[model samples]
Target: MSAPTYIYKLVSFSSPVPDPLPEKLPLSELDVASGFIHMSTPLQVPRTLKRFFAEDPRIYILRVKYSTVEKNIKWEDSKGEVPGEVGAEGMFAHIYNRGLGTTEIESVAIWERNRDWDEPLKKAESWLVY
Candidate 1:
């Protein structure tokens, strides 16, 4: 099978950088506590946002392509560790870069309430593969 072209990371709208994301994304509190970078497939993003993101105003979705971090990324069982749908018993992508690790940024889009989550959601839905 061909390798996955992309994976997704959700960041707060108020990111560290003025841009949507920084050179290396800062891990969430949960990621820091668990010692892994939690990622989602297109299928997982919507539910992940609903379950964990709650009613936040500005959520940024990071589109990370495989070429960006091919060696560093691994698909492993989330093992019910993540808080949302990703926590279910299924393999999820974990970018194993500790602090400010290597991950190529393909593109970034915002997900705000009453705004443009639909197109991104549809795009993300296309990335689902087991």
Candidate 2:
């Protein structure tokens, strides 16, 4: 299948996301320590939640227009922190050189992490801008 036109971001914070999100999102702890913002494709979001956010009650999902942030994104291998870890074996998008901006986001949604995290992502195509 062709690559998606958008990339997705799952954040584990409780504050309501500001409209038009801040030009430079306060980088997550990992993102700050690593010096890059971590992002995934639509199909990768659910697994990401299950692997890294299972304990969180809810997470925010950001649908980012790929072309808008293409210059800053790098596709790199993520072989988990160790091995045999779920959701950490593919090439993921990492934003470097600058912080993510609203100009690149198409929309933002919240997912209540539960037994059904993967349901909405099954309709990933519908999340495309057009």
Best by TM-score: 2
lDDT of 2 by residue, 18-98 (tens): 776887577777887877788887667667878887777777888888778778766765532322222234768777777
lDDT value, residue 95 of candidate 2? 72
lDDT of all predictions:
0.63, 0.69
Q: Output the worst ten-in-a-row residue range by lDDT, candidate 1.
A: 80-89
User: TM-scores for all candidates?
Assistant: 0.69, 0.77
Cα displacement (Å) at residue 71, model 2: 1.4
- What residue runs in model 1 are displaced by over 4 Å at the alpha carbon? 14-17, 79-89, 98-103, 115-130
Q: Write the per-residue lDDT of candidate 1 for residues 71-93, one digit (tens) a residue.
A: 76666766424432222446677
Candidate 1 global TM-score: 0.69
Candidate 1 residue pairs in clash (backbone atoms < 3 Å): 42-124
Model 1, 50: alpha-carbon shift in Å?
1.2
